[model samples]
Structures are given as C-alpha cells and as structure tokens.
Target: TEGLVMAKNSSAADQLELIALAVRGNVSLALAARAVRSAVEAGEYEAIARALADQAGRNDPLQPRDRALAATVAAELSRLGSKAAPLWQVAREAWELERSAWWLAYALFREAEALLSAAGKRDAARDVLVRARSIARLLEAAPLLAEIDALAGRGRVDLGSPSPQLLDPVPDRKLPISDREMEVLVLIAKGLTNKEIASELFISERTAAHHVGHIFDKLGVSNRVEAASVAHQAGVLVEDT
Candidate 1:
C-alpha cells in the first residue's frame, strides 16, 4: 500500500502528475490504478472527480486507452464501502460524458449495490439494477448482463423494467471549499494542529495555516471546531459510524 500511503500524503497536483506520467508512458497503468485507488481511499474524492470532469470536458477527445483507464478508476471508486454516493456521482458523470453505455450501466449497477448494501434501500437499489440490466441488454454486453443476473440471483430481488429517468445524470453542484481546503478541513476535524496538518499533507506549516485561514473564511467560521461543524452540516464530511 505504498501508493496508498503516498496518495494520502501527496497533494492533489502531485497525484495528477502521477496520472499524467502514466498517460505519457513514463509510468505503468498498474501504478496509475494504484494512485487512483489510493486517492479514493484517502477521501480525495473531489479532486478525482474534478480531474475526470476536466478531461471529459476537453474539446479533444480522450484516447481509448485513457478512457478505459478513467473508467477503471471510476469503477474502483464506486466499489468503496463508504462515501459511495459521491464516488458514484463522479463515475456516472464520467461515463455519461464519455457516452459509454456499458460503462454507465456498470456504474449504475455499482451504485445500486452500494444503495442496497451500505444504505439498505433494497427497493431503490433493485430499481437501479433494473436500469443497469436494460442498458446492458441494449449494448449487448454479455458480461455485464451476466453480472447483473448474478446480482439479481444472489439478492433474490425481482427487477422490473428500466425507468426512463433512472440513468439520467444528476446535476453537478459546486462545493464552497476547494479540494485542498477540504483536505485541510478533514485533518482539522481530526484535531490536528497546523503543524500536524502540514506534516500529514506534506506541506509547510505556513501553507497549512494559510489553507486553514481560507477554510475558516469560506465556512464563515473563526476556529477549527466551528469549521468542523460547518463541514459536517454541509455534508462535506462523512458521518461517523
């Protein structure tokens, strides 16, 4: 889990650099996947989402290999046990932007599983899986279809026909805090001092203080406790289990 450790400590820009290097053949896809997995596990969710969105929004289309890699990263995020909603949102956005029906279906499938397993919304989850199954059929993706069948069999849930709106992308909402600021906020919530946050995030104490100041301003709070309160209320921080 060296990659995971590195990703937890590195800045978002450094993580993106690793991805770029992978794309340019300076690093292996395995390393790229590790970086992506690490980012997801480290809760650098917004950073990953924004990077994928930016790539998707580019006028120049992504190469097939890059698209596949992006899809892989999205899929990995979708499978996370916690924070699945945000991750699935990012994955859905990427697949929709790419117009990859199969990948979109897969993303839906994972979201449904997360809903069922993590959130305990069985009926809603089944509905989403139904949407995924329909898309898989339309694309003639036998593997995806088979996986859907397996999921249905295992869950013993009767899936209905797809709802027309089930696969539609949710509108993107902007967060008040930047990704770097969010990282600082999370560490602050953990009761880390500025020096500690700096060490954890691999930045200077002065830079960490600067980020803390920005976070306080953006959140309209004067201290770490108030900042954590605002972040929790805003749903920026995951609920404690």
Candidate 2:
C-alpha cells in the first residue's frame, strides 16, 4: 500500500526505491510496475529514462538481468506513449554486442511494442516482432514465442496519439540545472538566503549552497543576484502578482 501511494505521488526517486525493495523480496513485481507506470504518467519520464541509461552504461557488456529490465521498462514506457526511443536503442545495442539470443528476443519484442505504441509505425512494428519471433523460435524461448504470437494475434488497436502537453519543446536557452537545482533557483529568485532555501527544501545549508554553485555554473552567472536575474530574463522564473 505504501508503495502504491508512493507511485501515485509520481516520485521517480521513490519509485526507484520501491524497485529496490522488490528486488529484495519486500515488494511485488506488480506493485513495482504500477509505481513505475505512475511515475511516467506523472511526467517523471526523464528521470526514468536517465536511470535506465545510467544502468545501461554501468556494465561494459550489459548483464542479462540488467538488459532484460531495461528492455522491459523501455517497452512499458513505449506502451504509455513516452519518448523511450533512446532507451530502446541502448537495450538493442547491448544485446547485439553480447550476442545473447534470449534477451535479444525479449528486447526485440519490446522494441516492436515501442515502434507501434510510441512511433505509430505499424508495418515497422510488425517487422520487428517478426524478427523477434524468429529469434525466439531459434532459441526455443517458448514464453517469448507465446508473447510474440499473442501480440500478433491481437492485431492493431489505436492506443491514442501522444498528448500535445507531453510534447512541450525544451527551452532554446535551457541551462544544465537539474529539476532540484531549478527549484533552488526559484527560491533564490524569491530572495531566500542559502539557509532559508535549505529550510524550505528540507536540505542542509551546505547542500543548498552546493546547488546554488551548480546553478551559477549552469546559468553562467557569478552570484545569486546574477543567477536570479538570468532566471527571470530566461523566463524560467514566475513573478508574483
């Protein structure tokens, strides 16, 4: 229940914690999946995508378990119409490099789902699944083969186009500030000192100062005053009425 609540809150960090708990036998896989789905729905797509990318980058050859998990998450994001193309590419490359047939088949199945659900490329999706089925058959992966068959049997159903709000363009003058760092910048704009900002954000003053330094570096500013000015000029800060 706590896991579900955390999922409902859409905190990517909390969802990742829930996943760790699942790996430790403290939570169910279903609950973890729900939490991840909720986080994606809540616009935590970049966090999840970044996490998957980090995981893919950690292992040189990409362990089978890691590859499977990354592929599964990428596929689920695709099903939810998230921009998971990069994640899919990472999984595909890892599998190809390792020559792991079973995981490759699994990744292919998910890649097909991404193609169909996210990109709306039906013919391409079918071709991907066809290749997955071939690999599954060759490796005697019965479960994967069954899944491919079921997907093929269902035919195409509209999953609805992605929402325009989800397609909002990144700012041309986007700084490298992280989401938390942006929050720090907002507080700075409000004229909050580092100690006050730390209190407001429930972090230590040292941490707040660290974020301020990062904000300065990312925004190409030297001090809080300059950072605040740049934030306002860049339309990154909202003014009070």
Candidate 3:
C-alpha cells in the first residue's frame, strides 16, 4: 500500500511537471493539444479535460491555438452531459481547428447520425448512411464502406418506418478489411488500446500505430469508439478481449 501510494504520487507529479513544462513553452502547444486529443480519443475524456483545466488555471495566456483547444475541450465536456444543441454547435466550431480530413469526415458522419436519430427520422438516417458510404468509398476506405453498407442492409426502409434490429448480435463474417486488419478490428472492438495491441501482437509501438491508422482509414472512423460501435453492429465484438 505504501509503495502504491508513492507510485501514484510520482505519476501525479510527472503529469504536473509535464504541464509546467508545456506552460513554460518547452513544448509546442500543438503537442499539448495532441496529447489532450489523444487522451479524449482513448476515452480518457475526464483526464483530458482536467489537464486542460489545470493548465488554464495557471492564469497563463495560452497561445491562440491552445485557447481554441480549451474551448473545444469545454464543449466536449458539455456534450457528455446530453445537451444536444450546444453540443452540435461546439462540435462544428472545434472541427474547423483541425486539418485532419479523417477527423472532419468522422465528425460530420457523427453529426448526420445524431440529426437522423434525434428527429425520429429513419428515412433521413438511411440517406445519411448512403452519403457516409459515398464519402468512405471516395476516401478509398473499402472496409468502412462495407460496414456502412451492412448498416444500410440491416434495416428495412419504408417511408421512415422503424423496426430496429438487435445490434449486439449480427453476422461477424461481414468485416470489410483484410484478415490481419480484421484481427486488429476485433481487438479494437474488444476495447484494446494501441499499446495493448502492440503487446498482444508482439510488435513495436510504431507497427501498432501503423495498423491502427490503416484500420481507421479502412474502417472510416477517426476514433476507436466509432470503430467499436461499427464492430458491434457487425457482430465482431467477442465475449472477451
């Protein structure tokens, strides 16, 4: 217990030290923003937000980019609380700050999905799915396109009528990537991080990063949560990690 406490304290100190270094301009604000975004993408949203808040609390005049990042993080926190209107608005504002096309496509897809579902509009959902399919195809993201196709195929479409299928159990063999990519997808669906994937695959972290990049491109997702959702829809999620 004593050793564990010391370790925890050391970890906290390290984080604080890193934050201080960042504030002192020892690192680019973009690097700090990337770290925060990575934390959020890894589903560590609270940590990301808290870190941002801590930096902001230091009463420093953050670079314009960092200020924008802070605003985005605040918006994400609001979104987590189920405020639909504000959430969507903030999501768009934040989307403009990043240059990653994959990220923007993923965000737009999310917005379309939200709009479709929120208005009880199944027909619109189908349309959005079709558009998402087109975008994924244009990006040469075949695996993601297949996943979208599967979604479109799973439900009946008749004048916005709704008969939702059981999403947790579907055909697992319909994965759209190569076998190796599928293996990574299954692990991702099981909620494994890239580090964990590297350890499991006995590969270097760089190799694992490469696989994850390919998976995201092929899967048409910019983050793991979306990939996991699609995997669940396709019945790729297994009982264990």
Candidate 4:
C-alpha cells in the first residue's frame, strides 16, 4: 500500500530524515554496505574510493577490491610482492607514498615487509627500513620514524641507543611562557603571597591562586620553589650563578 504513495509525501527531505535515522541508529549497516556495493556497481568510482578509504581508516569491512581501479591496484600489489629481491625502485615508490601519506605507506610497507621477512630476506627488509627512514627524515616525524625503526629491527637492535641519525633537532623556546601567564608567574617567583599576586595583577586572590596552580601544572612541579626552578631552567627567569 505504501508503495503507491505519491512522490510529494516521500520528498527528498523525507528520504534525508530516513537516512539520518539509519545513521544515528546504525540499524542496518548491511543495508548501508549494500548501498555502497550498489554505488560501486553503478560506476561511482570516486565515491567508492573515498568511502572505501574511510572504511579502511575506521577498520570496518576490509576492502576486497569491489571496484575496477581497486582491483587493478590489488593486482599490482600482488605482482610487486617481495618474491625476488628488495627492488629499491619499488621501495622508493613506497617511500614516496609514505611521505605523502604515512598511513598509506604504512599499509604498503607492512605488506611488503611481511613478505620479505617471512622469506628470511633480512637484507631486503633492511632496505625497506632505509627507505622508510629517508621518508621519515623528509617528514620530520620523529615518533613515527622511531616506531618504524623499532618494527624494522624486530627487537634485534636496541632502538634507544643514541645514533647521529636519531637526533632530531630541538626547537628553541623564548622564556617558554606566554606574556600574560609570565606576568603572574614572575610575581610568584618573587616570593609574593597569592593575595599580593592578586594586588599586582589587578585580579582577585582566588583567580590569582588558580593561575599559580596552572603555573605549577605546566612546570610539572608540585610547589612554588620547584616551579621557580623550572621557570629559571626554561629561561622564563634569569638566575645569577
């Protein structure tokens, strides 16, 4: 009976409301999945790719290349599997992708590395590591590089050992404080009570106490004296030797 209803009552707005309800409830993800499959069947490659990538990010249903382009990619990946050698060119291609999108590179590297390592090809695995490190250097991503190094070595080598390549430059901070917060912290470092700090900053004593508490938290210290020492170390305050 409802199938005979006119298009006016079942407007786009009504369709949208139904979509919202389905999404809010996750009532039928299989139906949603079928919709995506239908879209892919309809030659909506761009939309399918975006949606597949999003699902990949969310760890949802794994992509089995339901689209032509993705199927070609899967075939290419299969052909490029580490059956022969390290293939530096392939490694470099993976590195370039890694530089552009770390997660994407991560996916490719994980697959390639698994194949190489499983075959007991340590040299090829090390080559993959070198390319990954090069990409990491380009991106200035220390933590990610460290993680890759750790996984590449498979605990055979200690990652914490200091090496020239591991040294990422530290950034300089001027006083390590914002001007507004520094104004209040300096008064505290001068041995002023909270009430006195309030009088100096023209704020309430309660507000002054709150600021001092925040200062302690930021400095990672429990008391005023340690906070002062941190401030001096941070160059927020100069102390004569």
Best by lDDT: 2
Residue 225 C-alpha lDDT in model 1: 93
- What are the per-model C-alpha RMSD values against the true structure? 19.5, 20.0, 18.3, 19.5
Q: Model 1, stretches more than 4 Å misplaced?
A: 1-81, 161-241
lDDT of 4 at 227: 72
**Mind giving the per-residue lDDT tens digits that candidate 4 earns over 55-173?**
32343222222222232232233333333222323333433434445643444344434444343655555556565666666777787776666454331322234333221122464
Residue 112 of model 4, lDDT score: 38
Provide the lowest-lDDT 10-residue window in model 1. 162-171
Each candidate structure's count of clashing pairs: 0, 0, 0, 0
Clashes by residue pair, model 4: none
| Clashing pairs for predicted structure model 2, backbone only | none
Q: What TM-score goes with each of the models?
A: 0.41, 0.40, 0.33, 0.28
Off by more than 4 A, model 4: 1-101, 155-241
Error of 2 at 116 (Å): 1.3
The candidates, ranked best first by TM-score, are 1, 2, 3, 4
**Candidate-wise lDDT, in order:** 0.64, 0.65, 0.55, 0.50
Off by over 4 Å in 3: 1-81, 84-89, 96-99, 120-131, 151-241
lDDT of 2 by residue, 62-143 (tens): 3455555665565455444466555676777778877888877887777776665443567777777778888998988887
Candidate number with the higher lDDT (2 or 3): 2
Model 1, 109-196: lDDT tens digits are: 8777666554357787788888889899899998878777656643445776322221112234244777667768877887889998
Candidate order by decreasing lDDT: 2, 1, 3, 4
Give me the overall lDDT of model 2. Answer: 0.65
Pitting candidate 1 against candidate 4, the one with the higher lDDT is 1
